[model samples]
Target: MAASSQGPVNGVGEDKTSVRRQSEANRKLKYISLAVLVVQNASLILSIRYVRTLPGERFFTTSAVVMAEVLKVLTCLLIILLQKRGSLRAFIKLLYDSIFVQYLDTLKLAVPSLIYTLQNNLQYVAISNLPAATFQVTYQLKILTTALFSVLMLRKSLSRVQWVSLVLLFAGVAIVQVEQEGKQKETTVSSGSQNYAKGLVAVVVSCLSSGFAGVYFEKILKGSSASVWMRNVQLGIFGTFLGLLGLWWNDGPAIAEKGFLFGYTPMVWGVIFNQAFGGLLVAVVVKYADNILKGFATSFSIVVSTVTSVYLFGFHVDLLFTLGAGLVIGAVYMYSLPKAASPSSSSSSSSSSSTVSSSSSAHSRSHLSNSDADSETDAFLPKSVLVK
Candidate 1:
């Protein structure tokens, strides 16, 4: 090929075009992930809210909660299935061999995932009881809670501006709570007191638990070598089994009665889709993105749930709720400011890289220690570490 006047023929500027295209491709991927996350969370919220409408709702409402738990198991299975077959076997064998790793490696994540599950249930319960918009406002407190846990659990600090914005977010939460108190309405149900009380307690606990889990997952990935999905899959599986066992022991097989064995309906599948895929999507997001950035991405769910409830169900929106939502939105943006890359940030990034390298080395040594025909196959799988 002959050289053109503008360049060293095809070779000269090829790299530049390739670089530009790659950048654009990455940007596109980020946008796609964001879309996936919003849809998933919105579906999840919608399904949970639907539980409130079941006639003589207590049984169905509790069953809905159980269904959510089963979805966690489905998430695990899906995540594991998504991995390379070799990787799955290697990870499984490693777990099978070490009792400590099995407990701390697999089950440890459940503590935090359970926390997240609790928060999620609480949000649904709250929405089921209070005005729909009220739950939206209080739920915005998640950004602040996640931010706080990131600092405490990860020993990662935010900038002063980020802290200020988080403070504003809390203020927003307080504003909504106070406003909702003033606008509280009289209940019509006979056992309104018991229902609302149990619901409120559940909501608060679940939200805090989920918030802590979000922080924990991020920290865990920094210290571990597995892909984001690996850790999440493990956590989801553990969490699902735990939740199912607990709920089954406490309640029974009511939600399972709604399972897709007989002439099932779209509503039932919608619930399954919401819990299964929705749980995985949010879990992946929590694993990959920073909580601050995640807060912005996920806040769209609030809008979706609110619009659906108000227009679809004729729920009322209050002024204080609006203010609270605004605060959360603002807080998400503020926290998302590119952290002024400090020594600490650089150090954390470096440590994460080192952790991956060390884990890789450990995996290589283990396979060599085995020194067999399957060693090569095992070596292909990435190693993982147990992190607090």
Candidate 2:
């Protein structure tokens, strides 16, 4: 009788313990995800800063980009191999079978991949010419451009709050640019105006390309059941091809004169690896978290990068620049908020909650069965013992 009585109690205790364990596990996972994002962002910033300090007439931008693409491809291939249990024959067979369809689908993404590669090169140019903090701040303009592209390509409509946030974002970026220009005027740096103009143009083009590529990539992802890693492999394959073409177009004569990888160095390899791995880290974060979390991560990274730049590179941060950065960060947060709950969504949530409650009640009933059996057994016991 005592054993039966304790059965339900112990079961409930076990359930509670499991719930607590799961909750703690989830909290730890969130922390780990955030740390990955922060580290990746810091690595990217440091790599770019290192690259900008290199003294050379040759940037090796094309070669670095191609190497990054190749790294991505190899990383994806490694993942595939692991998934196939190290069966090279199976991997080769799968690749051969999917070659035609994958290539066709990859071609669709290739155009945007090429655009993203160009944007990547432009980012290097902007960072080389501008302070890291300033470059980071200006890159936030991509959010506004992305919204524009979503409207055009995805037929998505924005709420009034979203539109207001975009406007604030734009204003904030403009203020930062003005502050940079004023500082340039006061410094009397050689070719300051020309370099600033070039940086500004590169930033704008990068934003436009990023917006289009992001929206197009989203569309592709939604249209297919391919895994994220698979899609990345396809993009990397095409990106490598496009990088080769770009290298030939921009550096063919130069390569002939100086040979390939003339400007290569350990630092160059560091930059390439950082860029490639950073992208993979982003994919991992996206797989584990929502876009809202991703946005927060990026905003936090911007703040960290800005502060680090001030300390390490002696970046000037005036009142206007601070205000602009604050506004931009605020806008990003506002933009990431979920839209007002629609009636349909509310109703669905209500139904889901009801279902959950029903399941919980059913589970409780199941647990009470042992107690019910105990009660039945208690009926067979003496009345004095049951009271005890």
Candidate 3:
């Protein structure tokens, strides 16, 4: 009996060890992911700002988005080419059906379309009002906002560590914002605090809208007709039309520039590059990796975002503010960890269900066997003899 018990205990010990190892591996992966995200955001800031300062730069907010969408469609087309090891027409047609196809009637697209426009416009407004450094701060706040919304709006529960991290992250952002504001005051006295506040509001709106978009896109992916690109293509087309209308409304066509075929500038190319590859590189990493890794990749993003904005652009960085930024980033890591829900609980649930099912099956089998035996006995007794 002791030998038998020892065998079971050893088996359980091995199982526990296996689980712990897998969890540890996932944790490390998440950390690596956080660093990668930081690099992506930093590079994006540096690229966009640099392009804007270039000679004959035509990368207005609208142009940038349009170019980006164009590149996405192009990328999709390229993907189709690569995957088309067989019948090209059939494959292309299938892709077109998936992407160019629309499931929702015009009305369904109308509402989200309107909302997307408002969100996009708000982002441009923020970009215009604030510098790269300030914008990065606001965007980085998404991790906190996402967590907050997850708890409050989505009614999701987070661990204590996650909650603490959220608080630390927020504190850090607040500190960074304050420091950045002070620097802004010293450098350019053109606009007052009110403008910064306005920009901040816009940035916040942008973040919230993006978060909402993610939800909607997920919802649609659970179902949509147009491939992600085709869907994006429609969005780009619609957004451009509205943008043109807004431009036309604000100034009338007297100031309208002719020849809008992407303007063919290097900045235009950069926008394409950024959207298609640069930005998506991080997304691809995030998608394949687990949540833990995503947090890890984006862990230093806020700091990188701040540094890239300040240093590369010759902006300011307050030590206290940077410290705060680090705190916020630490919060992101805390938030990203896997929950410690026990495997035993799941195992117990499975066992209970199995017991019930096994009992039911056993009873059915028993009844069937009894009936079979009775039939066999009756057959053994000859029909006429059994009647007596």
- Residue pairs with backbone overlap in model 1: 115-209, 115-210, 116-209, 116-210, 118-206, 119-206, 119-207, 122-203
**Deviation (Å) of 45 in candidate 3:** 1.6
* Number of clashes recorded per candidate: 8, 0, 11
Per-residue alpha-carbon lDDT of model 2 for 11-58, expressed as tens digits?
A: 768866876796688667767777776667665765676666655565
> What TM-score, over all chains together, does every model reach?
0.70, 0.83, 0.65
C-alpha lDDT of all candidate models, in order: 0.54, 0.69, 0.54
Off by over 4 Å in 2: 1-6, 56-58, 186-194, 339-388
Error of 2 at 313 (Å): 1.7
> If both were scored by lDDT, which would come out higher, candidate 1 or candidate 2?
2
The reply for model 3, stretches above 4 Å from the true place, is 1-36, 53-58, 84-86, 99-102, 105-121, 148-155, 190-195, 223-255, 261-268, 339-388
Per-residue alpha-carbon lDDT of model 1 for 158-247, expressed as tens digits? 788888888987888778667755544433343353244454555555546545666665555443444444554565565556556655
- Candidate 1 residues lying further than 4 Å off, grouped into runs, are 1-9, 54-75, 78-82, 85-103, 113-123, 186-200, 216-222, 227-229, 253-265, 282-293, 339-388
lDDT of 3 by residue, 130-238 (tens): 6666676556565565555556554678778877877787787788777767766654575442256667788787667555544443333332333333444444455
After the best TM-score superposition of candidate 2, give how far the Cα of residue 179 lies from its true spot, in angstroms: 0.8
> What are the root-mean-square deviations of the candidates from the true structure over C-alphas?
8.7, 14.0, 17.0
What lDDT, from 0 to 1, does candidate 1 have? 0.54
Candidate 2, residue 46: the lDDT equals 57
